[model samples]
Target: MASDSLLLTADFPRTVRGYAPSAVDEFLRSLGSRLDALQNQLDQQAARCEKLTADLSAQAKELAGYRLKEAALAGALVATEQRRAEVEQEAAGLVERAREEAEGLLAHARAEAEQIVGEARVRADQLVAEARQARQAEEARILDLCAEFDAAVETMRRTLEAHLALLPEPGSTLAELSLGGLAVADAPDSLAQAA
Candidate 1:
């Protein structure tokens, strides 16, 4: 045969006596629902935060790429500016060389012109002197020939009158006589034949 044991319990306080069993049950159920709603809100906020963080990181990476490209372009710009300066310097040297060459050529041309003018002046003066000498010689020859011709004419006049008295009434004229020691055949035979 088995025997059963009885259990004894202490009495509740006055505040605990006014507590309703159904009311306690309702409060616990409400609390559970509120906790579930809060958990749902917190989960949504965390998901939004993750998406925003991912977008911000993507934007930062894109900005870094843009900055790198800008830096490369800046380097290229500097290189171009340096090359331009070098080219300008080379061009300036070329211009100076060209100007020097032009000046040298101008000097050479001026010297050549002066030399040519001087030569022409000297040649012209020589030709003028030679012409003057030739004219003086020809004039002196004419004067000498005139004096000899006057003497010969005087001798012929005295002899011609004596010879003309013995001749017939028809007399020889000056045109028929040889004058200035020249005859009709005075030129050389070859020259006469060619003429």
Candidate 2:
């Protein structure tokens, strides 16, 4: 029982030492934040898919209901076969009316679909544009940072080379040196200028 209580000791954290744990904790926090963002985006996308699926299911149900009503009418009418022949005889006239109705429905559906798709396409384009702009900004920042780093590194190399020139080598001067042997000298300000 006492050993079980010892397991619950909160003072263990206060006893820990060094920057190692703190650095690890910072890295974990950063990783957690990124993962949380990804999770949220995934959740949003899942919700969108779920809603779209539900809407499509409802539309299918409505269309099925219409089909059932049409079938019921044809079944209840005993003279359906005779009427079907008459309807077929006037099919040419009805065909035009049906064509008009179908065209109207198609136009409406197309307009609605276009409205939804256009809005989505616009939103997607905006998001893509924003992402591209963000990428460009990040790339510009990285390029600037890289240029600064390169300049700093070149400066450090030049300083080191200058210091190295002040030290005496174990061997001879530049003109006295063979092809493979190194000779000590200060670095030129610019290789292009030296050339």
Candidate 3:
């Protein structure tokens, strides 16, 4: 692991066992060149490693952001589901209340209809009773008129019979003069029947 500066500047002692200075200098120069090439290769590798580390860090940050977005979307989905359930419950309650109200209204209407029918029936009965009373009164009045008519006819027949008794016998001149076209026997009976 000799440095390039030390290799270039190293000196050998002059002795019987020492190597030639020219040959040693040549070998040291070759070793220094090879070391410099290896160092350059190592520096290039280090630069590539640093760039790859930065790229990895950026990708990790992007992955973390995507995970956060996914979590937020899941939370939103859960909240939406809860809200939809609440709305469905509210709609069901509203429908139930409407049905109850409609049933109540129907019951009320039925009661009113029954009451009205009952009143109508009572009024009809009253009207029928009044009609029957009026018919009975008219019948009684007609019967009284018939009785008065029969009594007047009986009084007129008696008056005619008394007048016929005052008349002469059938063949008399006075009877013939008084009853112009009737026979005496038929006169009283015919006049009474006509009356």
The best candidate in terms of TM-score: 3
By descending TM-score, how would the candidates be arranged?
3, 2, 1
Candidate 2 residue-wise lDDT at 56: 96
Arrange candidates by lDDT, descending: 3, 1, 2
Task: Name the regions of candidate 1 deviating beyond 4 angstroms.
Answer: 1-106, 168-195
Per residue, candidate 2 scores C-alpha lDDT tens digits across 62-124 of 999999998898786757888877888899888999999999999999999999999999999
- Each prediction's TM-score versus the true structure: 0.32, 0.33, 0.35
What does candidate 1's lDDT look like per residue over 63-150, in tens digits? 9999999999999999999999999999999999999999999999999999999999999999999999999999999999999999
Q: Model 3, range 1-195, lDDT digits (tens) per residue? A: 458778778877788878887888999998888888888898989998899899899989999999999999999999999999999999999999999999999999999999999999999999999999999999999999999999999999999999888767777663354454565545787663553
Task: Name the regions of candidate 3 deviating beyond 4 angstroms.
Answer: 73-195
**Candidate 2 minimal-lDDT segment of 10 residues:** 3-12
Off by over 4 Å in 2: 1-94, 166-195
Poorest 10 consecutive residues of model 3 by lDDT? Answer: 174-183
Error of 1 at 185 (Å): 41
lDDT per prediction? Answer: 0.76, 0.75, 0.86
